[model samples]
Target: MTQSGEVTTLKGESTDQIFNLKREASIYYSDSLSTFNDIKSAFIKSAGNSSLQMVFLLKGKLNGYLTGSKKACLTFAEQQHNILLINEKLQLQIKTETHEAIFIRIDPAFLSMYIPADHLGYLNLKDGMQKNEPALFSGCNLHMTSEIAAILNALRTSEHTGFCGKLFLESKILELLVLQLSQFELRKDDPAVRQLKEEELDKMHEVKEFLMNNMNQQFSLRSLAHMVGTNEFNLKRDFKLAFGTTVFGYLTDYKMTLAKRMLIEKDVTIAEVSEKTGYKYATHFSSAFKKYFGYLPNKIKSGKLSLLILIEDFSVVFENFVTMIP
Candidate 1:
């Protein structure tokens, strides 16, 4: 078994020698973030175990199932969280084109330092899975809030190294802990809300993928619900539970983020970018862009020195995650 904080590679056979593939897994540990990068061309399973782990999927999609069990395939989407209570029955078949995530491994004793006296019981229950015979794994699909996204993006893109960079990274990790705990508190009381079944979650993911792929096309909740074989109410409820944003809210943020990328990276005109991102009118697109990004699209195109300087300045402090999947 490969040790933690090291790389593991496996080569598999194929009909054409050129088509054979090698998969690599590496873990990087620090005081705050433990980043895991897995690049694979075929299926793979865990050879080593871990302590109680909180995994945040930052990029790519992965589907897997436990070995020697009848449970269905589990889908892990980008911007989601998975809580795994590690144990022997935790063998998994994780397969993806490429997978990258951040895993925070914690022991209950150490974690208690971060919890308040009032919340100790809650943390205890969550940590209780470690004592169970079979490992327990729970997952929640959360919308990447703009705050968390900004910090993550900065962390991913920063060029800084040494003690200063490490300090910045650790602060962001603590911010995520606060945000995640707050979000958890918001939902933990809603026992009336049903937890989505595996198939239901899969269908919701399909709905999300569809919306993302068709960003230029307009979609109504009713139409989307029908496309995903669900009713509108359940669709809205589950999407919010899984993604932490209303359907239209998520779509708008997505469109605006895409628009920013095009404005910065592509040589396309404002009208062209607008049409490409689903706005029929440039004025409407400009207004939405301003609202979302605090600057008009023309400011980006006309090379307004002040706004451009502002963006560059912010990039130093808060560059958004450039690797976000469109």
Candidate 2:
């Protein structure tokens, strides 16, 4: 990833690059990501802004401890959260191997919109660091909902293939944001985390850029949240709003769309096509493939029917093929 901010490198296995997501914008955009990385990471430094982040681990681990506490572990498919107050030093250690994440950055001004000037007290927020050695918000790692997991899976398969490639990604990003923002009550506990600004919706394009470019790598939401300075909740919520669909929904369709294209435009073997599209097993790929396209991958290769006609004829043959894929 290209560094827009200060960046440091650790000597372990490293995969770092920047993705420039595309979207049409009118107003209320913030600065692009200044920093990002993915590796066996530990001890993240403080960001300048009051940060929001999303972190997910596809593999390897994370350990969080304060002062002299035993480590809180993050593992495969798990997510974690951390919020730091202003001017206070906090120690956080992250460790990983062949792990990855996707992230978005939000300015403090953007966050201030959610928290009013007066309620900052009842918010009981910290600026520096938590004083207690044993913490109450000890569950620093988050639990991603199934829906959130689906979206992350989708993010892993997004593609920038057409004029609307960016458009597809833009919408997915927004959907992710909306999904996350809907849960503000979890953090604020105010029961009134209001709707996000429409202008904020414009940032969905940035998210799309990240996912479409990084589709091949296994990406977890929490890992990304840390890199970009936003959290899983915010990404999901804003993504929903910006895209008008959940992240996974868009990704599912994108992958299936490519499958359909491969079925029609080329003579690649069903197994080859499946693996190329990132499916590991041909049998499972065939099942998922037919479920999406209403025909066997082999049948589609024959060029015997138009896609529209296949849908029309689906009522008759779909039931038969669905049973045969396995």
Candidate 3:
């Protein structure tokens, strides 16, 4: 391994890099850029060390099945993340196309040291680990957030060396894990979400789709609930459980994401983008954009801020900003 704790190997058209961090955590990154004719299958057998495994697929697709299961147990695509607790020996067959992914294996005991036993996330994880079955931390595949993307980018391009490098890498890994756990905790603590029937969950998804498709419009809790054939209270409660955010909260994030993409096009003005995202005034849209992204839309248009700087600013302010939003 290099002083940066990375060991790299190249086989055929693929490159794999492994970083061992503090003996309790390790990171595996793979990039495969091959045509359909050169596709490959990889078989992975778990070490059965009771570690928590987090996987992030940045590009392309991966499909896999367990050793005993006839059906595919794993399917990952670009911009998706999943967390699993591996406590027993298991084998997986994975087929990959042109893709880049990062896998992190962290000892649960190491996490326990940082997370209190009374914590809902730790308790849920502990219960799952004791069952001796592969446990999923997320109910559904999580879409990668800008914050997560930033941290992953840092991990991929780290420049620090030796002990300092190890420390930096460890800290980043822990930060990423904490973010995942917090999301799980939020959903787990929501009893309304836990009690949701399949039909109710479907309604929540429908609500989300409607909000996303109608960004140029606004809906109150009662109107959305009515449209989904549910009551306002159930809609408000279950929506948070299903998506980890309020109806309006989700809409605000969607609008901000769409606005950012629109701002990147040179011909799109702030006023036009604001209108597209349901903001009556450009100033209101700019204020919300700055709050969500920690920078004005003009910074993106001007190309003045580097991605690293934007990430740093966003990370510092995102938590506080989210709470300020409705």
Candidate 4:
């Protein structure tokens, strides 16, 4: 469903044939899901023109074709990489033949709120530094690697609830942008050499926290930079470095964090909480949770810890033993 060159414009869901990605904040938090089938069989068949989009693979390999005819298959395997396709938006045909995946597709307008909007169209997704850009996630054509994963995990504790969730999520996204650029650097060109001054980096952190708590409303990095009196690009750079993530990553993670907590604390059924978490389906959450936490929710709450995952997370649990001498 894509034309693949110069300009993309998807003003809104144009066809019933396409699955409308459910972004929760829009309904003003007053509306609950119309149904639990939000995440399944989501086929964006024959995508109309779009401005640009960001797709993150949560599981499986998705063969994405630019148009109805499969010119070449885009192999996305459990990675998050943003691509700026130049088109007046074209027909994009998406299908999960290998394994069903959950994708968070965002409009350029929504994305522009955080960074230099020009970079969205300027950055190249395909030409990366990694030779041949390995297709399988195991290979490295894509990132969302465990390294970024570690940084992300630590940033989101149970405390921030509403605020911290947003900050960490944005930080994670910025980190993701850098990682993707690094892959491009590994292949074609070197990434831009711009490091935020130490002080600006400090404020970038504050900006993220502000956005996190207020993501539902409109925002702009330029205005934010001015208010902070820093360059937008610098703020973006430091924001990324300090958080070790990105604006988008922070948003997605923040949403998922709520989903996780709700599942754990609110005692909501997985189906209900999935929608609340911005997931259209529960299967996606199940897969993501198992991958992220090494266990499903029941396993986590059951007090049944895996010997393997436990060792991975807490070596002391396996090595240290206490005994009473009688």
Question: In terms of TM-score, how similar is model 3 to the real structure?
Answer: 0.58
lDDT for 237 (candidate 4): 68
Better of 1 and 2 by lDDT: 1
Better of 2 and 3 by TM-score: 3
| Tens digit per residue, CA lDDT, model 2, 102-214 | 44332334334333444432133433223422221112233334345445544444433344433433344444444444343244563533434534433545555566555
Model 2 compared with the native: what TM-score?
Answer: 0.35
How well is each residue in 1-326 modelled by candidate 4, as lDDT tens digits?
11121111121222211223332111000011221123212212222332233444433444444445556445544434445332322233334333322223334343344334234233232222122221121122444443544433343232333343333334434454445545533333325534345466457656766765664455676887776778787766665654446656665566655655555456567777666655567798778777765567666445443333323433322222111011
Tell me the deviation in Å of residue 289 in model 3. Answer: 1.8
Tens-place lDDT digits, model 3, residues 1-326: 12222323111112222244334555666654432112222212324445576778776665555556777665664556777665434443335534667667666766666666776556666777787655666655565554576677666655555555555656676667666766665556656445456688679878877987787776688998999898999998887765566788777777876776566534688899989888899999999999997778887778654454435544644554355233
Q: Which is the better candidate, 1 or 4, if ranked by TM-score? A: 1
Candidate 3 — worst ten consecutive residues by lDDT sum? Answer: 9-18
Cα lDDT tens digits, model 1, 61-178, are 5444555766744555665765445445444333443455555443444345455645633354355454543232333444455455555554444444444443444444445555
Give per-candidate clash totals. Answer: 3, 60, 0, 45
Global lDDT scores for all candidate models: 0.54, 0.43, 0.62, 0.42
RMSD of 4: 21.5
Q: Judge candidate 2 at residue 67 and give its lDDT.
A: 45
Model 2 accuracy (lDDT, Cα):
0.43
